[model samples]
Target: MTRETLTWLNTMTLIGHTDRRGTAWHYKASEQGGEPNHYPGAIPLKDVRARLFNWEGVHRRVAVELPASTFTEATHYGLDNKPMRWEVIGNRSALDRSDRDTGAVFGVVGPDYKIHQYSDWLLENVAGLLHDGLSVSSAGLLKGGAVAWVEVSVPENLMTDEGVEFRPNLLATTTMDGSSATVYKRTITDVVCDNTRAVALKESGAEFKVRHSKNSELRLEQARDALQIVDTAADEFRRQVAELCAIAVTEDDWQLFLDRTVPWGTKTGKPDNDYMRLLKEERRENLTYIYRNDPRCAPWHGTAHGVVQAVNTYDHHVRLPQKKEDQEPDRVSSWRTDRNLQRTVDGLFDELDRETYLDLEAVLEQAA
Candidate 1:
C-alpha cells in the first residue's frame, strides 16, 4: 500500500532471531500483538522464504497527463475550438515497484536501475553460509519491505583469555529505498552486552557494496570472494582483544579517563548549577558503577579492554531517549547501534599506541 495507510510504529515489520541471543530486543514485536519472534536455533532458509519475503518487486512504467487549460485557439483543436479535457504528456515520471498491498514504493529509478529479487539475493548471498556451520541468527524487514537484512553467525562462540566472549557475524543487507547500496559486511557482537562492533580495524575495506545498476547480478562471484575474506575476520579481532587486555589501567588512570570522557560542567565550559551538577554527577556515578560492577564490563576491570567495554555497555544499555516518542524502532535502533559501535572501535584504535597512558587519554577525549 502507501505509507499513509500504515501505522508509524511497527507496520509490516517482522524480526526473528535465534534464542542464542535471547529474544529479539523484547519490544521489537510488541505491536504485532503476539509472542515475541524468537526461534530456538538458526532460522531455516525455507522458513525465511515462506514467512518474510514471498513477494517480488517488479518495475512498472510511469506516465503523466496534462490538463487542457494551457491550450489556446491558435493550437490545433476540435471544431469546438477547445482542446481535449486531458492530454497525454511526456513520460516524465520515473519507473518504480512495490508489492501492491504488502510493500511501499521502493525507489524512483531510471531505466538502468535493476530490480534484484529478494529470493535471488538470498540464494546468492546468504543461503550458502548455512552449509558451512554459519546459520541465520537474525533476519527481518523494516519500513514496510523497503529494507531487509539477514545476520549469519558461527555456532561456536570465541573468547579471549581475558574473558571477552564474542560472536563474529556476517550482516547482509539490501534496501529498495536507496538508503544504502547492497552490502555484505563483517561485524562482531559482544555476548555480555550484546553490542555490535566492526570487525575491521579500518573502515574502508571491511564490506563489499554493489550499486543497483543493470550489471549488479553479474558481480555475485566477486561478492562471494569478498565474503571469503570476511570469513577470517574473527582471527584478527581476537588478536586485537588480546592486545587490549594486555594493557593495564591503574585506578588513577581510570579516574582520569572518566574525567576526560565524561567532563564536568556544561558544553560551554561554564561551572554547573546545582541541578546540572547533580545530573552530571549521576552520569559519572552510573558509568563508574558499570565499570566497577556490571558483569558486562567488570571482569576485565584493570585493563584497557575493560574501559572500552564499560563505555560500550553504558551506551547500549544505560542510555535512554529523552522522550518516549523519541525512541527508535528495533531495526532502526539496531542499525544505529552497530554504527555507533563501529565508531567506538575505530576511534579507540585510531588513538591507541599501546605504550603510553597519554594515547589512551587521547582516545577517550576523541570519543567524548
Candidate 2:
C-alpha cells in the first residue's frame, strides 16, 4: 500500500507505509528530528528505535500504540500524563503463541505512557497514607485500556456511623476515540459490593474533563488538588448519607417514589411485552430488593437517600449478566453507566419543583 499522510488537527502529519523497509513506519515534520524534545525536523524510524532501546533494555515484549505521546500531536505526554505500564508476553513465548503476531524489533517503548507509570503515581500519591497504615485495598486496569483506578481507606475519623469501611478511590480515564475527553474523578467505593459513586456530587472533588488537544500542562496543574479534593469529598459524602437517612419515606411515599423513579407496567396495570419495558420492571424489582433486603439500606429504607442508593447500587453492582455473552458491551462499563444514571437521577432530583426533602406527596402535588 502507498504511504499516506495523516495530518492530525493541523498539528503534525503522520506518514507511514507497510511496505517501507519491511514494515517500517516514519513521519515527516519540519522539526529537527521526530524524536521527543528534539528540535523539529524530519526523522527516520531508526532514530526513534535507537532512543528507546538506549533508555531501557527490553523486559517484556508488548504491542504499544505509538508514536510516543511526546512525539504525538494528540496525546499530552508530561509528568501528570504519566504512562501506565502494561503486561506483555515474554519474547520467545509471544512468538510461539501466535503465528501472525510478529513483534516490532525496532520501536520506541520507554517514556511512552503505560500502566506501570500510572501505578507509580498511585504508589507515590498514597505513600504518606501507607505510613499511617492505610493500604491500597484495590487497584487494577479496567477493560479497553482507557481507565484505571486505585482505592485506599479514609482515616478513622472519616468513617460513618454504620461502621462500614467505605474507601475513596481515584479514577483516571481517557479515550483515543473522539467521544470523550480525558477525565479524572474521585469516587467512593463500597468495598463489600464493589459499587462506586462519583464524589463530584456537588463539586466536592478534583473532577475534571481535560481536552487532549492543547494547553494540557495548564490543565494538569489545575488537577494538583486531586488528593485534597477526594478527602473533602469523602467527608461530604459521609455527612450527606447521614442527612439522607434522617429524612424518611413512608410506604405510600415509597410507592409513589417508585412510580416516578422506576415506573413499570402499562396503562392497564399489566406488564408490557416490550423488552425495554420489561427491563424497567426488572430494575424496579432490583430496587425493591435493595430497599428491603440490603442490610446497609435497611435503616434508610423507603427514604429519599435510600432510593438513590438502591438505584446506584443496583446500577453499579447488581445488574450484571450471568454469562459473558449476555454482557452489553456498550453500556455496562462503570464509566458509561455511572455517568448516564447519575446524570439522569440527579436531574430528576434537582428539578425546579423538587424540594430539599423526599416528600412524594409534595412531588406528586407539584406534578398535578
Candidate 3:
C-alpha cells in the first residue's frame, strides 16, 4: 500500500474482528481483535486501547476507511502522532513449566490505580485490629454472676469486668439481650470478634500515626475511638464525591482539569447556556447528532455535554475550557460516573453503628 497521511480521524477498530457476547468481558487486546497476522502477534495492550479510546475521543470520523484487506499499516495521521501497530518478534522458555512470553513486545500497561487502592485498604483494616483489644463482659451479658468470659478480676476500685462502680453504676460496653439471659452464656471468642470488628470499623484510618500506648487498656481505648473517627471521615469522603459528581457527570469541572493540557482552539470556549439547555431537550439523540462539530455545536461547551457528543460520534474529541469562567476548567471530553461509591460507604456506616455508647470504656453495642 502507498504511504498516505490520515490527518483526519481514521483509526476506529472494526468490530468485525473483536468478540463480545453475553456477559464475558475481554481486556486482552491481542486476543480480542485484528488479524492473527503476527498478533497471535505482539502489540502493547495500552497501544491498542489508546487507539480505541483516542478513536473514541475523536468521535470516529474518517477520511478514507480501510478496504476489506487486513494488511493496512497503522501509522499516525498527525505528523506527530505515534505509529499504532505491533508485531511479536521473538520468544523463549524460562523453565520446563514456564514459557518465556518475552519478545520485542511493543505496548504500555494499563494504569495501576486499582492495585494501589487495594493495598491501601489492607493497611487501614489491620491497623484497627492491632489497636483495639476485645472487652467481652458488658451489661445484659452472663447473668447469675457466672459468665463464660475470660474472667480477669481487677480491684473493686479499679475497672471491673462490668465497669467502675459509681453513684450510678456505669454500663458495660459489651452486652447481651437474648431470650434467657439467666441461661445463655456468651463465648469469649464470639464477644472478642464483635469488639475487634467494631474497633476495626472505627479506627481503620488512625493506626497509621497514633502509637500504641504502653498501657494495654489505653491502647485498646485509643483504637476503638479511632474507629469512630474513621467512620465520620469515610462519610465525609462520600458526600464530597457526590457533590463533585454534579460537576463530574456534567463535566462541569472538566474545563478546570482540561485547561492544564488542551490547546486554545477556534471555538469561543465559553459555556453555552444554549447548549446546557439542549440537555433538557425532549429528544436528545437527534440533538446530540447535530452537536458534534456541526454548525449548531458552538453551544455545547460543558465537559459532560461534549462527552455526549463524543459518545454519539465514537470519535476522539477535546474541548478547551472557557477562560472566561472564574475558575479555569480542565479538559475531559470522556468521563465516567463513580459507580457503587456510596454503597461502600453505607456498608462502613453499618459496621460503625454496631457499637456506639459508653461512659468511658469501649462501646460494645448501641446504648439504650
Please list the C-alpha lDDT of all candidates, in the order they appear: 0.61, 0.43, 0.23
List, residue by residue over 177-210, the lDDT tens digit for candidate 2. Answer: 1334445566665443334554433333446655
Candidate 1, superposed: residue stretches over 4 Å from native:
1-19, 27-36, 58-97, 101-111, 201-205, 265-279, 327-368
Write one digit per residue (lDDT tens) for candidate 3, span 15-119. 111111111111223443453211221223333323321211001111332322233676333344444443332231111101113322212122211111111
Specify the highest-TM-score model's number.
1
In terms of lDDT, which candidate is strongest?
Answer: 1
Ranking by lDDT: 1, 2, 3
Winner on lDDT (1 vs 3): 1
Better of 1 and 2 by lDDT: 1
Error of 1 at 261 (Å): 3.3
lDDT of 2 at 159: 55
- How far off is residue 350 in model 3, in Å? 24
Q: Model 1 scores what on Cα lDDT? A: 0.61
